[model samples]
Target: MNMPRPLIPQVMTTPPTAFPARIRGPLLKLCLGAGTLGLALHVFAADPAPVPPATTTPAATATAGAAATPAAPKAGAQFDWSKVPPVTAPSRPGMFVIAPSGPGYYSLWDVVTGNERKAPPVSPNAPYALMTNPAFEIDYRYMEKPGYEPDLFDPIKRIHMGEDFLLSFGGSFWYRYMRESDARLTNTSDNYHLIRSRFHADFWYQDKVRIFAEFLDARSFGQALAPAATDVNRTDMLNLFADIKLANIKDGPAYLRVGRQELLYGSQRLISTLDWVNTRRTFQGVKAFWRTPTFDLDAFWVRPMITERNQFDNWDTKQEFFGLWGTYKPMKGHLVDMYFLSLDDNRHRALGRNGILGDSITHTLGGRLAGDYNQFLYELEGMYQFGQYSNQDISAFAVASGAGYHFKGAPMNPQAWLRYDFASGDNNANDGRRNTFNQLFPFGNYYLGWIDRVGRQNIHDFNAQINLHPQPWATFTAQYHRFYLANKQDFLYNAAGAATLRDATGQAGSYVGDEIDFRFNIHVDRHQDILVGYSKLFAGNFLKATAPGVSPDLFYVQYNMRF
Candidate 1:
């Protein structure tokens, strides 16, 4: 029963969701763009403008009025943090705000200091303050009936206060609503709605340590329009977690403190917790980070939070997960990573846990490497899994690998990826298959392209994509996907009929099938933006053989903004 959602008959027919209350699109965009432009100009035209000399000696000043401008700093040197100015309080005229008291020591003009100037004072009057503004945004989407496909477009708004102690400590707020056009064949068109909202905040104790947290909520309406469709309007517990980090360590390199946090490895093709769905991937755990001259290493362990929906059916069962990941950048733009991960499944028996009665224990070992060359980014990864056989003696293995290339010029970056997946299971064995893509994590949901050639379960997928950044604040992306059965011989003509493997050879063989998706994102302002998108899906002869008319088509769009 643990199958990919797309493979589930119910999900395939389910319509996509829609956004919340509509808003003025054009006016909203104009306001946001103008705000960003104005802020940029202000930063460039501040009073007492600090302008350094164009050249070191200026070929001996053309006129006596010229002062010896300081030499330009080297390009690849570390940024100086000492020159930061001090903060002042309105109530106490002579008092300085937020004096240095925490982990990392504070200094002004450190970002660009030379032997001549020891360091700048940490005062607002010095130069610039380490601060940020917070913002929020929202979007709503919808579609029509019949095909139950999607037509997505919505509205959004966002805002942010300057990054002062109060604003920074309060975090940020965001809300999004999407009405999907697809739902299973229950004929529940326009009946599914999803509302997501989150409140985030961060607290810094001293300069070296910080605490971050977010409260997320998501609700779904299956068929609120129909009194009989109670199944359509259920609320979901998406995400609720907190995490902290300790940046400067007095004795050790650095100690990373984590509670409930999200982690992403290399390209994420083999290991991702899809956050785009609104639920966002999360795990309750802790981790430590060690940084040395050659590399940085992270190690952590976690367990399910056991929210209402994800609670284990059997409370008596015990489950635990742990992992160790490390990254080494021998040179700039080159990163290599290796990890050992383990997850215990108390819900199902391991493949070979017991001798005669023993089931198999699921285990995965994987590693990846990525590099940036000029404007091109590339990723290479591989993973191997071993454990349990549904019906046979001990013997099962799974392997996965992925590669991608990104084009540089323009915002429309072109990229492609190839993935090969193979695992052990009877052509028809039904063991516990892990859902690698369903997790609620932004790192998991983001893809280089727009196809799920590997739409969950035990299927092989090949995918590719192109990203176009035509407008300065907007991006358009497209993707294609193809699917195939792990083994062709185990296919059957009909589930109801008693036809054996031999009689099913007459069915069409597994082959070409693909899905295309297009998406556009526009930045309305520094704090807000809008998104629009659509997709078309098709299945070739290969999918037709597995089940008649199994492939379905769709289109969707949504707009979002922050205030």
Candidate 2:
């Protein structure tokens, strides 16, 4: 009913290159944002209904049913309750959890047959309970057991405001200490501290009407360089939305959700909440969904929110992002997802091969397949893009695939996986087509390497990792990555999808370098965790030839408590 586990995914972005700098021009037309907005019109078609009788409810929609699951309600089908999680904490009253939440990623098949998903357990660095449900949308109805025992905070989770209205509360806090050498491979070093906190209130009037709102605070200190754009949102609204169930699960369960919200869909390659960063990502818009026992479909139209360091966050009025994502679980162990996404950015003039161009409109169509056979698991996804970026025609694509095996009963519960990823890049600046793939908003750090380099645009990554759960409360992971340029003429992008290095003449050679990372996560308890990690990049020919001749290293220790 909720999400967690691994299925990583990417995009392209901004700055350092040896080529001559291009000057900006006047505004491009708003035709794209104005033109494609019709696609978003369907999202607001809602017929709000009166509060209905109370009944048992399931998880709300997240994104894709790759965003995985029925986007809204496969809520009817439950999970296998007999399997005990290897990691668990005794639930205390007033606290959020008393037992393990169950497998992070499990399908109806796994639930029906007591099968395992054959994937690594959840880790702090990449946490989400039901891949389809972010922490904010968790279904805590299970907490209401027969003769439920009350804890100091128990009353806060389910408060009776009236005869049928139920209001609940939840929040989380995290602190991190970090150090980096050659930050951004700029021949520099620094140390910093970060703190973030969140609080939210959820309201439900029967099973068909609801409202959810969350607050956020994020800050950083003692950094030598200018803080990244996402590092500082002192205080603001993170998620504020309302959900209306259009129909009951028995009648093809459906929902219409509106307002500001966070989105996560298939493997999260193209869309995600991006929780790894202090200021997580969100959007303001409308979403509608419908699903059955084995499938679900989601449609949405929203504007990406712009985070400001000193003021309240606001949606980017110049850009509009919309999409359709669908998922099908053919029996449990196997799940398939398909999606079509579009983005229009009219904030600034787009630099084209010939000169300045008009606004941008990008359209993408992609699909993903994932499942497990006994102890072996596998995933594959492919995407292609078309449309316009200023005066240039857009033609780009990306692919992600991986296979793994879990030694379930083995000591430490060891597991390993190998993966390959590629996204097209443009080789000719004078060409009429823009070939670089836009990662959209994604959790790129999970797949591209934690060092925050090597985006999904114009790049190739061959990587592998091993996970070991040697203790009930601890997890250890180690990964190695080899990166290369898909097209030397295109810029080298970083994890946040910004262009950090480039050799326009193609003299840099394609090899970007090698990175080895190690991390550890300790499950202090169900609601608390600690994470320690380090990464080092061995500069390859590309970095040595184009940017500073430096290899970067990063280290951090973080503590998180969620209730």
- Expressed as tens digits, the lDDT of each residue in 1-563 for candidate 1 is 22111111321232222211111232243235434533433343332222221111000111111112212322442422111111111110000111112222122122124212222111111111101111110111011012221211111111112222111321222333333332221223443444445455444333244455555554455534542211121232222232234443321244544455544443444333333444444455555654433344556545544434432111112444555555554554455666555444444443321222322233456666655456444555555554333233333344444444555442333444444444332342333342221111112113322222233323455666555545323445566656554455333221111222221353565553566666655433323334555554465666554444444433334333222
TM-score of each: 0.56, 0.78
Per-residue alpha-carbon lDDT of candidate 2 for residues 1-563, written as tens digits (9 for 90 to 100): 11111111100111224211221111022224323432332232232222211110011121111121112212332432111001111000000111112333232223446554344232211232212235554544433333322344566775655555668888888898899998987888989998999899888776567788788899999999989988899778888777788864432446777777888776767887776788889888777766544455677767798897777777786776777776655554566777778787887667786778678878888988876667776788899998788888999999998887777667776777888999999998677889999999877877788889888899999999787765534567788999999999889998788888888889889999999988777655445567899999999999998866689999999887767
Q: Which stretches of candidate 2 lie over 4 Å from their true place?
A: 1-133, 147-152, 249-252
User: For every candidate structure, what is the RMSD over all alpha carbons to the true structure, in angstroms?
Assistant: 20.1, 11.5
* CA lDDT scores, all candidates in order: 0.35, 0.66
Off by over 4 Å in 1: 1-191, 207-210, 222-253, 256-258, 270-273, 291-294, 309-317, 349-360, 374-376, 388-457, 489-508, 561-563
